[model samples]
Target: MVGALAVLAVVLILWQILPGALNVPRYVIPPLSEVLVALTDPVAFPRYVQNAAATMTEVGLGLLIGVVLGLALAITLTQLPRVYGIVFPYIVAIESIPKVAIAPLFVIWFGFGLPSKVVVVVLLAFFPVLVNTIHGLRNVDRDLINLFRVNGASRMQIQVRLMIPAAMPQIFSGLELAVANAMIGAIVAEFVGAQQGLGVLILQAQGRMETPAVFALLIILSALGIFLNLFVRLARKWIITWERT
Candidate 1:
């Protein structure tokens, strides 16, 4: 995979350079050399890291909140039949609303700060977790549940010993997706209104028509995405420690 990436990098470098070396208009595209040239400078690089950190901080907090609330809601909806009848529809309705459409309201209400970005991230990230967790819990192996009952386990014991453990993998599956969504949502929230962050830097670069800087921000953001994915994969692997069996 590393070799493949290196090959692709070489190809892209060649692809980007071939045109500009022949004097392709700058308006058409900047060369890979130009992109690399810009990348060499340290001044523009740290801002990308700072902004990425800001966005990641918001995403981490929001994903944590979203996962907790989603799990709580999913368990409630599954365990109590009566609660589902009253609450599930509301959950659907709230989840159906466009997060971006209401993100400005979050900013207006929570102010243009981390709180608002975190709120947006949670709103966008929770649905996947909620739906997946509910599905996982409600679709437990009937035999295992029955075995627990036959053993005279109470509801809490059934939940703790059987249901939650069984559902954990699926829950983490949703959580992985939610983490990515949370990051995207945080960046988008910042793009709409933020004083610092990659999204803000992108907006600034866009306003200035700084193509190399824009590309630089994009590269850094992509790296952040890769790291987030790797971390989540590691977390999921740890959470499902029984999967090896």
Candidate 2:
């Protein structure tokens, strides 16, 4: 925490000094003080809070749906090798398509509302979890499986007692990736079409040439992404304590 604070302080000092030192225009890069003022402005702060809440709601819901679906599909594939062989290629094909290209299709299907944003988040977040879970499960120690078989352990028992626990670290790694993707997906959906969200606020600020407000919004978004990533790291430590042991 102290290290993070020190880095933040240095960045803030640089942000406050660089533009003026370089004789840059305020319209291009507002000073940190101007951005802080925009961030704390009474008229704008409340709206920012509301839009942040909306974006977070979409991110949370989409993360839940995507992670659940990905885990389920991964487990199914692992349990059925024939199905895995048949479906893996198609999964690769689907993932090859750029999510930005598909965002419009979701907007047309779900409209300019929370649903569309959630769908985009799901699409972006799902692949990481699916890929990681499959990799982890497939790479489980064969000796462990043989030992379980020697004990006459059922397939379900082997999975629950050994495989899942061993795969948790990789799954958590996927979760970290999902966290960033979820935020990006929400913002992209908002950019495509939305009445409220940080993305929309950014567009509005840019249209009005509110450079300070734009910088303020970017700061808020960066802070949010950092917070979410830190939360995931904490959760990973809790869930995989054996790693530290």
Candidate 3:
């Protein structure tokens, strides 16, 4: 932690000084101090908070729905291999489309509102979990499965007591990827169309050529992404304790 802090300090120092030293244009890349001042502006700070909250709401709702749907579909496919074989190709084809390219379509369908942003996030977040869960469920130990069968364990019982638990690592891996994708989706959707969000705020700042404000908003986004990824890691540690042992 101390080492990380030191590295951050060095980066901040460089950010504060390098522009002036290199005779770089402030409009192109503002100094760190300017960005900090922008963030701490009394009038703008409140607006930033409100917009960030709106974006977070979209991310949280979309993530919950996506994860639940991914898990359900994965479980269903695992239990019915024939269905998986039939639909897997179609699923892959859908996943192949660029999510950013579809953000405009979502806005057209759902309007320039919260629903569009949430739909984009769900599209970006679900596939990783579905793929990882399917891989984990199908790759379980044959011996362990037979042992459960010999003990007369019902299919549902084995799924709950064995398959899901065994799949936790893979699920968590997917979740980490999903969190980052969720952030991207929210921003992209907001970029395409939204009443309020960090992405919208960034666009406004860019339009006015508020270089410091744009840099400040980008910093906030980077910090948010790191915090979310860290949260996922902590949750993985807590839930997958057996993996560590």
Candidate 4:
């Protein structure tokens, strides 16, 4: 932690001094001090809160819905190989399309609303969770599965008691990736069309040439991503306590 803080301190120092030392225009890259000031600017702070709230809502909704859908689909695929063979290719094809490229289409379909942003986030998050969960479920120990069968465990009992627990680690990894993707999806969708969000704030700052504000917003986003990643880590520890063994 100390080393990380030291590195961050050095970066901040450089950010504060480099533009002046190298004669870079403030409009191009404002000093870190200026960006900090923008972060605390009383007039803009409320707006920041409002926009951030919108983005957070989209992220939360999308993450919950995406994870649930992914888990359901993974379980279905695992239990029904024929269905998996039929639909997995279609899923891959949809996931193959660039999410950014589809943002505008989502806006057209969902109409510049929060629903569009949430849908984009769902798309971004769904595949990772599905793939990871499926991988974990499919790779369970055959010996253990046979043992369960020999002991007269029902298929549902084996799945609930063994498979899902075993899959938690991979599922958590997917959740971490999904968190980042969800953030990106929300921002990208907002950029395409939204009345409010950090993305909209960024577009506004860019339009007004408020470079410091833009940098500040980016910093806010990075911090949010970090918080979410940490949250997932904590949740993983709680849910997968046996992992420590």
- Per-model TM-score on C-alpha atoms: 0.90, 0.95, 0.97, 0.97
Clashes (candidate 3) = 0
lDDT string, candidate 3, 1-245, tens digits: 99999999999999999999999999998999999999999999999999999999999999999999999999999999899999999888987888678999989999999999999898889988898899899988999999999999999999999999999999998899889999999998999989999999999999999999999899899899999999999999998888854
- lDDT (Cα, 0-100) at 163 in candidate 3: 97
Measure candidate 3: CA RMSD: 1.2
Tens digits of per-residue lDDT, candidate 4, 202-230, equal 99999999999999999999999999999
Report per-prediction Cα RMSD to one decimal. Answer: 2.3, 1.5, 1.2, 1.2
- Candidate 3, superposed: residue stretches over 4 Å from native: none
Which portions of model 4 show Cα errors greater than 4 Å?
none
**Cα RMSD, model 1:** 2.3
Instruction: Please state the error at residue 218 of candidate 2 in Å.
Output: 1.1
Give the lDDT of residue 32 in candidate 1.
70
The residue pairs found clashing in candidate 3 are none
Provide the overall lDDT of each model, using Cα atoms, as 2-decimal numbers.
0.83, 0.93, 0.93, 0.93
* Prediction 3 TM-score vs. true: 0.97
lDDT of 1 by residue, 39-147 (tens): 6668877767777789888888998898888888888789999988898888788877767788888888998888999898888788889988988998899999999
